[model samples]
Target: MAGTATHHGIPLRSGSGLSYRFDPGALGFELLPTGGPDWMARYEVLHTPEDLRRWVGQSRLDPTPEPEIGAEDVPAARALRDALWRIGLARVAGEGPADADLATLNAAAARPPLVPVIGQDGAAGWAAPATGAQVLSTVARDAIAVLTGPYADRIRICSGDNCALMYVDTSRPGRRRWCAMENCGNRHKVRAHRARQSGE
Candidate 1:
């Protein structure tokens, strides 16, 4: 999140204590911004096989320990991320997601993300090895549901400074802008106060 450089052609941001943006339940699209900028200097979280494993855990897509993630999993995950970003951006712009992106997403959705099983005491839970491909599929399925679901219209890009994170504006007025008040919202308020004092 601090250092700037390139890794395997993708921009890498490295620093201690760098954390992911927002809570997991806030938005499924948060993974796309993991690398950094959507266009330039993006630090791909799925850059390595290990990164892929960590991403699955971080996303909470599956807590099950995954088998070895291969080199191929990285690109597959990145492709899914890109497609989700495009689809989300299109919705924000009042346009429909492209056919190609939809197709890609649908394909992934068709795959079984995880197995279901009855747990102790008759409770149900998902079970799986949490392989790399399955993780990507889970994310794709989430994106598809969000884009096609009722709340899709409420999605918006965060208005915070230098923040490209996307989120659902569940505010009552539906006029929410920043991803979170503690992060970008406070920054905006501070800037506005400075401007007011400067004018006085």
Candidate 2:
């Protein structure tokens, strides 16, 4: 999100038990002055720190600070997660499948920025000394790998309310519910109880 670059098209929204579809504008992504595709826009929407805090719940990973989470971080928590899900599914569904998506994410995240790799014979073959994104699309290749990597079990969508966010549940049983524990899950539970009372 910090980069000058922007991605085109809507990031596909997916879920395990159910799916919800809404335009990007519904989540507050706004159109820019320049002409572009329907989903292209500047965004007013993002996850608040509270949103994320509720999302992770009592997971093994410790909570991040309670600051104003940025517009940039939004994709990581929501769209990026869904994107990873798609990428993982596609890669796994391919021939000779192996789950290396988690590895891809770990390896990529483990890296620093790209430095140059010099070749012999005075020809420069651009290789980043590390696993980070390059000027070319090797970054995308790695990204695909990360999403479909061996840790596929950890990736899960929330069972809370009608939320459309997904997350990596690093729990012991690998079972997680709700996009946020205190709110989304609770709301769903309450709704269920009320429905039983009224017989929906």
Candidate 1 residue lDDT tens string, 1-200? 01111111112222333332464233256467565335633455557888866655555343434544789978777777777778878898999889988887787777766554555665444565546666566667777777777777888888976777677665678788876566677778999999999999
Look at candidate 2 and tell me the lDDT of residue 20.
28
Q: What would the per-residue lDDT of candidate 2 be over residues 71-117, giving only the tens digit for each residue?
A: 44444444433334444344434533334544433444453422333
Off-target runs (Cα >4 Å) in candidate 1 are 1-20, 24-27, 36-38, 116-125
Residue 22, candidate 2: C-alpha displacement in angstroms:
20
TM-score of 1: 0.77
lDDT for each of the candidates?
0.63, 0.36
